[model samples]
Every structure is written in structure tokens, then in C-alpha cells.
Target: MIGRPISRIKRVVLSALSVLLLLLSYTWISHRQHQINPQDTTIPSWGQLAEGAKKFTQPDRKGHRWLIEDSIATGKRLAAGISLGIIFGFLIGMFMGCIASVEAFLQPPISLLAKVPQTAALAVYFVFFGTGMKMYVAMIAFGVIPALAVTVYLAIKDIPSEMLDKAYTLGASHFETAYEVVFKQVLPKFIDAVRLCIGPAIVFLIAAEMVVGDVGFGYRIRLQFKLTNMNVVYPYLVFLAGFGYLLDYGLRFLQSKICPWYQNDSK
Candidate 1:
């Protein structure tokens, strides 16, 4: 953390140095590999695929030749899936944590289902939503919600007895005490819960898109693989990594802003 901050000049200099070092390393290694083999189908080591992005100016079946619509559709599905999925997951998770008998009853079923990989749940969702945004949302939510439930259940169970006793002494009912007292203590961690799943969400997102996406980074990857176009493949990899990184950083920023207390405690 201490080493992360720098003035604009230092930051720019450091970034340039990093880029130069990466280029030099890549060129040295790639040249070594090429000399070892007279005939290599591999494209250039760096910026080879960037040229494909320029090819977007060419033509699709329509006037707009690139898969830009597919990109937007995939992007929309991802954004909608993560935002709505997490909200519903959190609400459903709260129900899981807050109800005693319900929690007990759900445990056996949750455990049974939880042992299964979330991708396996797609068959169930596919039947209901049939490969649309709803299927994607359900897939994302089913994958994510159990982890949330585990966290919330632990949080609720770990609430101090004294806190509950104090609420009781003050004449708060069980439900009121749970909301006003128990929940306040765990709120910071709940924010962390939302932040925690952003990575998993993105991972599942790419997989979901790759499996069912008509257009998106994952689809681009599938397209390039089929065409045997390794040059285009590099761009898709770069794009996916860049998108995931930005999303992770964005969540970190939001977590810091909305959850100053959580940050302070961790520090």
C-alpha cells in the first residue's frame, strides 16, 4: 500500500519502464523460440492481434462488419446478470441467515446442491429460461448464492450474545433486534460479501458467454479458435483480462468509498 502512491511524473516513468522491460523480455524469448524452429505458425509475440481489431473497420454480414452488436449484447447480459443477480442473491441470502427453522431445513438441501458444480445447475436453468438472459442470471446467481449464504450464516451465528441480550433488555423483539442490532454489526462484512464475489462473477460470466454467447470476448475466442486465427486470439485474451481487471478495480474503489469502516478495521 505504501509503495502504490506516486506523483504523476513517477507513475508515468514507472509505467514506461515496465512496458519497455516487458517488450524486451518478450522479444528475447520469442526470438530464441523461433531460432530453435525453422517453421513456426505462431504469429509475432507482441501486438500481433491488435491488427485484427483494426480489421473491425471492414465488414460484417450487415453494413457494420464487426461483431459490435454481439459485444454490446454480451456486455449487457454481463452487467445485468451481475448487478441483478447479486441483489437477489443478497436478499435470498438474508432470508437464509435470518430464519432459524428455514436455515435448518435448507441446510440439507443446500449441502446436497452445494457439492455440485454450478455449471451443472445450467440444465435446470436452461429448462426455465432457455438460453436467454434469465438463464444467464440464474446460472450466475446459483453459482454465487451459496457462498453468500455461508458467509451470512456465519456472520449471523457469530453475533455476540451480549448484543442480543442488551437488545432484549431494552424491550426489542427478536425481529427488531435482528434488524436494528444484529444487522448493523454485520453490515460491513455484507458489503465485503458483495465485493468478494465480483471476481467469481466475472469468471462465471466468461464461461457462461463462452458456452452460450452469440457475441462477446468469449465468442470472439471461439470464433478465432475455429478459424485457426491465433492472431485474433491474442486480442480476445487481452480484452477479457482488461475487462476483468477494470471490474475488480472498480469494485475495490466502490468498497473503499462505501465501506470506510471495513477498510479501517482491516488496516
Candidate 2:
């Protein structure tokens, strides 16, 4: 009974109700705060939110919208960091899982890296890569790579020994066995791992931007917060939540298409 599935209509209704309740709660809180202080920027009303949105969308004297500029800058860094992390993490994990020597050599270092709090190592990243695109990419990549590699490594290890033996018996080389046999089995799980890494990657990127960034969502948020511009901050936060949700939904769609047989937690 606890895990029983609901109808599609029921699911939609429940989801809408949940969102409606959240909006109502926020509106009530904002109204109460406004009553106390008309000038309070902490809990912005709908009008304030609209004005904030316009401020971001409208071009400045330089004919550049802050929202678009920040989105482009942040999007580029996020894309680069996630891509590199996936590539390197997959390779390292595949090797570590399949090869004993590689595992022995790389495991300790990767484990140590995983233990290090990437956000706290901002100074290290700054010194090594400078306060530029490289720093943001490195921070995000390092933040998620270790966990991803470990996920892949474990997934690879979970493969049944009989499968590998059959592949070898049929004249499959180590390379063939690794890719043709092991890779397919692990692809779905790897995608899931990447999906899980998305949030952490965003956090790392935003943290770096907040600390030493000229432009990005994090930069804008930090700048506006300093000015007590809650209206702008709230909209930006909502936009970020929407963006992250879209990324997650896109990944889920991709996984469903590629691995139709694999069971995914869609909810």
C-alpha cells in the first residue's frame, strides 16, 4: 500500500496542489511582512517580482541584459565543467573497475580527492587556475568527478563474473570485454550517476562565482543581496531552480530513450 502507484490524473492533481500550496504560503508571508514595513525588501510582492524581472530582461545603457549575459557565461562554464568531469570520471572509473593495477594506483588519490571539500579549497583553485573560467570549471569538475568515478567503479564491479568469463571464452580481448561487455551493462547507471552530479556541479559553480566572478547567476545573486535587492534575488533563485529542474528532466528523458528496458525512478 505504501508504494502503490496512483493514476496519471491523480498524480497531476497532487503535483499542482503541492505547488499551489507553496505559492499561497509564500504570498501570505510576503503580505504579513509588507504590512509590518512597507519598505521591506525581504519578502517581495508580486509587483516587486515583476519589476525585478523587467530589470534583468531590459537592456542597460550598454544594450546588454544582465540575465542573458549571466546565463551565457554560467551556461558555458557549467557545460564545460560537466562534460570534462563525465569524460575523465568515466575513463578513470572504467579503468579502476576493470584493472587491478590501475585501481591500486589510483584509488587512494581519488578517495582523498573525494574527501576534500571542493568549495572550501577556493584559495587553492584560485592559486592554481586563477580567478577565471578555468577556476570555475576546475572547481565544479573536481566537486563531482570523484563521486562519479566511484559510482562507475562500483557499477563495474557489480557485473557478474560469469558474464566476463563467457566473453573471454568467446575470444573477446580485454578491450572488447571492457567496452562491449562491461560498458553496455553500466551505461544506464553511469547516466544516473551523471544525473545525480548535476546539483553538486551547480553548487560548486555558483559558489565560485559568488566568491570571485564578474558575471553569472551567482555573481548577480551576490551583488543584489549586498544591495538588499530581495526582489531580484528571489526571481534569480527561482530561475535557477527551474534551470536545474530542466537539466534533470532532460537527463531523465535521455536515459529513458537510450535504456528503455532499465527501470528508472521517474518520480
Candidate 3:
């Protein structure tokens, strides 16, 4: 218990130190920019960024707020999209993994889809779903599903044949063998795949939101960018990074709870 606590303390200290170093570096650059070119408006001071965040949280002239309203809007679309991708992708992956014929039939298309740039398909999605929340969800789902399915298929396929043979020898039916042996074995790996997909899913989410969204974190970023307010843009970008980190951490915690026996290389 003491060892674990000490390790956690060390991790916290190191993480804090890393962030401090980053801030220090930014401050140094800001100082140098002032010395060299005091007229530059692009490199915003941290204080300005904080003020921008405060302004963003408060109601704008139009009575709309980012922190309260658009943040939730983005969160909902992200949740819906990721859930749809993961649930359906897991099923598709399981089928492809368990059934050789299904794999043979689907692998080519799945591979092709995975290879295709998800951002490039934005126009196609816009045409079908139009400029609605569905378009955002559809884009993210389209981005995530194929890659996740492939990860699942490979994880299941990589399960040792001897395990399946043992299951069969023990009077387990095909479905039981597939579900009990293959599915159970692949669940942890599937979690890992989900972890991997989170970044790309956010990328697709932001891309779609920037292009077609009425309100979202991404929309706010794009809006601020258009207005050339680096103060708001910089802080929003940091917020986005923090959100992604939280997601990665949450998924890691979930993985640890569900797959206690699994050793995480990252840890």
C-alpha cells in the first residue's frame, strides 16, 4: 500500500513538473516576443487567455455561452457517436473474427474503409445527413467503426486455436466457444482499441463540428479562429486537450476495473 502511494505521488509530481516546464517555456517565449516585437498581437499572454475563458463562460452579447451550452452540445454528440461506433463496431468485429466466411467477405471492404480518410467523407455525410447533429455523429461513427472492427477482428483471430479446441473438446457448442473463449479473451483488447480510437474519434468530431455544427467546442474554436482571437483559441485548444486526456484516463480506469488481470504497459 505504501509503495503504491509513493509511486502515485511520484507520478503526480512528475506530471505537475512537466506542466510547469511547459508554462515556463511559454512564458519565456512570450517575454522574448515582447523584447523583439512588442506590437505582435498574436502571442497572447496567459492572463489574456484566462480572461477569454472567463468571457466564454459568461453569456455573450447574444446571451449564448460556450461552457454551459455548447460544451454539453459537443459532449452529447461525442457520446452518441462514440457509443454507436463502439457498440456496432464490436459486434461487426466479433462476427468477422468468429466467422471465417464473414471475414473473407467483409475484410476487403473494412480494410478499404479504414484506409479511406474519414475527413474526406465529410461532404458525402453532409449530403446525406445535412448540417445537423446527425451529421456530426455520423462522421465520428464512420471514422471510428471500421478501425475498431479491424482491431476486434484481429484480437479475436489472434486467440490461440488450442483454446477453441479445448472448449470444443469440453462439449461447448460453436457459439459458446466463440462467445466464451474468443469474446472473453478479446474484451480487454477491445478496450485497448477503444482507447486508440478516442483520439481519432475526437478529430473527426471536431472536423465535422467545425464544418457543419451550429454549436460545439469545435465550433467555438473555429469561430474564434475566424475572429482572430488567439486568446480564446489558445485556451479552447488547451481545454480540448484536457478533455481528451480525461477521456483517455477514464477509459484506462474502466479497463483496469473490467480487466484486472491484464497488465498495462503504459502503467
Candidate 4:
């Protein structure tokens, strides 16, 4: 029963119940906090949240909607960073996995990079890339690249030796065997690795934004927090959560479509 599957209806019901319980608990805690201090802005009520939601819809004094501006800025940086990271990581990992010499040369450095705390190295990124979009993109790419590369490397290693032998017996060249044979086997797992890197990528981007961002979710959150504007902060957090969920859902959908034969217990 430990790994038993549940009905779809049960899964839906249980998921809804969990979310309902969380909301109820938060509301109760907010109510109690409000009772103690009528002007408390720490735990905003539903009304405060509604007001905060309006901030997203309405333009600021500069006549720019915060939501659209932040979304575009953040989205572009994130897309650029993650795309670079994935492309380079996959290439490096594929080479390392296929070529013994490459593995011997690159493994130590990549392993060391993976151990490095990317967020803590914010100043290093700033020094190299300066305080602009480049810094944010570099931070995110570096933060996730090592892990993504390692994931691909491991996935490649996990391929059965017999498959490779068969491909060779069929007269496949080394390049053909590496790409046509190995690449296809690892594509799904690589996508899954990318999914896992999403969180860290976002964290790196946000951290950079908080420190030196002119416009983005992290910048807005930091500004509001300084002003004790919990109302906006809370709604911003919810929006971020929703954004992340949508991204994850999109990836899952993509994986299901492309790798229909591949199955996992992700859900």
C-alpha cells in the first residue's frame, strides 16, 4: 500500500482539501493578528489583498503597469538564462559522457562548480558582468548549468551497454552512436533535469533582482518590504507561485507530448 495508486477523483479531492486547509489556517492567523493590532500590515486580510491586486491592474505614477513591466523584464531574462544553460549543459554533458578524455578533463571542474553556492557568489557575478540584465542572466545560467550538466552526464551513463553494442554492430559511427543512439535515450530525462533546475534558476534571478534590479518581481518585493507594504508583497508572492506552477505545468505537458512512451511517478 505504500506505493499504491489512488483514484483520480480521490487525488483531486485530497489536493483541494489540502489547499483549503492552508487558506483557512492563514485566514485564521491573519484574523487573530488583526484583532491584536487593528493597523497591522504584516498579515493582510482579504480586503488588503484586494487592494494589493488593484496595484497590479492600475498603472503607477510613471504610467506603467507594474505587472506587465515586471513580467516582461523577468520573463526575458529567465528565458535567455535558462535557454543558454540548457543548451550548454546538454552539450558539455553529452561530450563528457561519450568521450573518456573529455570526462576526465571536465568532471573535476564541473563537480567543483556544482558544489559552489551560486547565490553566495552574487558579488563575483556582479564584478564580472556588472549590475544589469547580463548579471541576472549569468547568475541564473551558472546556478543551474552545473546541475543540469551532471544530470545529463548521469543519465547518459545509465544507458545499457548492450544498446550501444547493438548500434555499433549495426555499423553506426561513433558520432551516430552518440547522438542517434544516446541522445534519444536521454532526451526525456534531460527535460526532467531541466524541470528540476527551474527553481534554482528562478532563485538566482530573483536574488540578483533584489540586490540591483530596477524592475522585476524581486525588485518590487524588496521595495514593498522596505515600506512594510505586506499587502503588495503577499499578492506578489501568490502571483509568483502561480507563474511557477504554470511553467511547471507547461513542461509536464511538453514532456507528455514528446515522450509519451516515457512514464514516471511525477504526478
List the candidates' TM-scores in order.
0.78, 0.96, 0.91, 0.97
Model 3: lDDT of residue 124 = 93
RMSD of each: 4.1, 1.7, 3.4, 1.5
* lDDT by residue (tens digit), candidate 2, 1-267: 899999999999999999999999999999999999988898999999998899899998999999999999999999999999999999999999989999999999999999998889999999999999999888888888899999999999999999999999999999999888899888889999998999889999999999999999999999999999989999998998899999999998898898776755444
Candidate 4 Cα deviation (angstroms), residue 102: 0.5
Worst 10 residues of 4 by lDDT: 258-267
The TM-score between candidate 4 and the true structure equals: 0.97
| Candidate 1: stretches off by over 4 Å | 1-27, 36-43, 56-61, 65-67, 120-124, 171-176
The per-residue C-alpha lDDT of model 4 at residue 115 equals 93
Q: Which of the two, 2 or 3, has more lDDT? A: 2
lDDT score, candidate 2 = 0.92
Task: Give candidate 4's error at residue 254 in angstroms.
Answer: 1.0
Q: Runs in model 3 with CA error above 4 Å? A: 1-10, 264-267
TM-score of candidate 2 versus the correct structure, residues matched by position: 0.96
Model 4 lDDT per residue over 82-140, tens place: 99999999999998998889999999999999999988999999899999888888888
Output the better candidate (3/4) by TM-score. Answer: 4
**Strongest candidate by TM-score:** 4
